[model samples]
Target: MASGCEKGEKVQVGKSDLEEKILETATELFAEHGYVKASVRDIAKLVKGSNSCLYVCFKNKDEILFRIITDVGSDLLNELNKVISKHDDPVECLQDMIFTQILFSIGAAKKMKIYLEEQYQLPPSLKEKALDQHRQLYDLYYNKICEIEKQGLLYQKIDKVVMTFGIFSNINWVYRWLNPIGRLSVEEVALQITDMLLRSVLKNSPLST
Candidate 1:
């Protein structure tokens, strides 16, 4: 584990693989129970470790939640970049961007759950990083919207800033109620949300027709 776990991009992570294992377990545990209710022991038990072993891998439970939040955002941004790169037209990029975000958020429900519901568990240092990542996603959406409007592919009347945030807030908020086993599939929900946003905003635009 030493050779494998020590290769983190940042720190010389001791038992890094075990740390990820513990984090995966704790993410699910905290997502279901919230940070206050879930314990380090539960996470340790999930990973077949003692409490002290868990602490050696992670400073505390708050650090676990912080890691979960940032990891989820990292996963989300990676997917978003991959999906958006498939298109060249700014309008298609914007539309595809919406779909990309919806799919990532719904598919990565546990991570989304931790980020949206359990971020308060993070210490101030990690909390700021998580919030910064969240804000960057917001800025990316706004910049995309501005680019599309400037290209005349989007309705000029649209308040690109507010519309950008509105579109993101509406779509990204789906993780809160999304169920992996629920009536709607992830793709289905993405379609529904995308359609709603399009009809509301794109409906008034010339390019939409």
Candidate 2:
């Protein structure tokens, strides 16, 4: 019962299981300890296995880091999809999507931070896989902006691609200091972020009474 996990409820202890556990553990460990400090032994201790088990499952530490990078990118992609599934007004919908994405990313800051900070350590193929998923997620948002732009719903002069990225950059940086239990609510901060993004990108001028 490594990590004192109960049997059955405990993760399996074979090569396949060890691989999965190591990846999961490493995501957290890397967040807590960072890539240079977190080693195979640390991950093995949590999975009821040995360093040899990890080597069998992964060629090396970089490979394991790569896997974690892929997982986090997939998680963000899923969040983006979930946010857009609702069919609200394009303006409101995009705002909601940005807000939801920022809050969720903040909630998963440990994973997100590790994935961002350690991605460079992964081999080229691993970086490509993670980056490809990231690009697709951005493309989804970018294309949505383009569609709305065509409808005269979003600004035509402002580059949809650049605006989408600018919005993401503002929201993503919050994870550096945000707290789930902090004085500022995640939603409030996210809403403010949306206001800033919308002010910068909205095509239809705000209505004045």
Candidate 3:
């Protein structure tokens, strides 16, 4: 019943505290063992609840996976839209988009991992719903690229889809390498990536100014 939770963090959709705990534990297990390998019993064991308790909240493992993916995708879109609304300058918008996404991905690295990796395991109907969320996220970046192109700052030679996915390729896997407690803070890593990405796609790197 929670509409949304925190920015750059897992959004809680579970109705009860126990439901939230199941979601948290399930995300860790799914990210670690994959959706197919991780079972309802595995999740229930981790939550110290019976499988029936899990069934009470979620009909099946697929439902839990669907909820996690939906919540993460929705939270990410909300954060990205906020960045888009906050910045009038296309260059700045693009820069913050990179930062915001990287920040969110790292913060919810496990859920993002499950989202990127295991979402295909979902049944067709649920998969399409999840894919719709992904497409919206994709368009936010694609449209921002168009904005930059309109400003005559984007490098026109690169296909916009390629440009958008290139940025995605750069940021999407940050969860694999980023060390949350390592020398660099999350913001620092996000900024470094933003600078690197902007330098490649923009005619004039905004960081230069």
Candidate 4:
């Protein structure tokens, strides 16, 4: 298997069953132990495979982490794109964006945990690539803020950049405290958070009044 790739080239590796198991196990271990502490052998042990067997699917631990982070980021962008395509109203788009993001945060909590906590551990080249995906995600929110502003629905006092990050701040930490068996279902939490965020930004939100 190809373990190394040129700078700026996408890291490609097999996605066979064992590959997924390795990735999944790695995600859990990285989230629990921190990236620096989670060894490739630890991941292989969890997957019930040897280190060489793990290498057949991924080049190394860094590649495994890269794949996990980038895959989650890509999956998020795709879902956000779908939300954008389905909503005509910028407010609606922004609402669904918040809702979708919160849901994703909770649903992919472990992977999101690794994304939040371990991304800086990636090598410079791979780190840049990962950050690029994040920038794209950020821009998606920024663009929607722009759309809302153009329509004069956005609060005049709100800074687009600040608001964008504020939305991220609101949703990004949801995984830490949200309980799956809690009284509120995931959708309920998402909607309530979405409403709170929208109220802060929209000039005419019902909650804003």
lDDT of 2 by residue, 1-209 (tens): 45323334533455566667777888888999889898878887776666676766788988888777777778777777877777656666677778878887887888888777777877788788878887887787787787678678776677767898897788778899777787888888887777878878875535311
> Candidate 1 at residue 168, lDDT?
73
Which tens-of-lDDT digit does each residue in 31-139 have in candidate 4?
8889999898788677665577777777889999999999999999999999999999999888888999899899999999999888999999999999999999999
Cα lDDT, all candidates: 0.73, 0.75, 0.87, 0.87
Worst 10 contiguous positions by lDDT, candidate 4: 2-11
* Native-to-model Cα distance after best TM-score fit, residue 7 in candidate 2, in Å: 18
The lDDT of model 2 is: 0.75
Q: Per-residue lDDT of 1-209 in model 1, one digit per residue for the tens?
A: 33212222333345777777888888788778888998887876676656777766677777778778888888888877776688777666766778888888777777887788777767788888889998888877777776766665565566767687779788768887778678988887787777677655553543345
Question: Candidates 2 and 3: which is better by TM-score?
Answer: 3
Checking candidate 1 for backbone clashes, the offending pairs are: none
Candidate 3 residue-wise lDDT, 1-209, digit = tens: 43333334353555477678888999999988889999888887777666776776788898999999999999999999999999999898888889988989998999999999899899999999999999999999999899889989987778999989999999998998999999999899899989989988988896868
* Backbone clash numbers for all candidates listed: 0, 0, 0, 0
Off by over 4 Å in 3: 1-15
TM-score of 2: 0.83
The alpha-carbon root-mean-square deviation between model 4 and the true structure, to one decimal in Å, is 5.9
Backbone clash pairs for candidate 3 read none
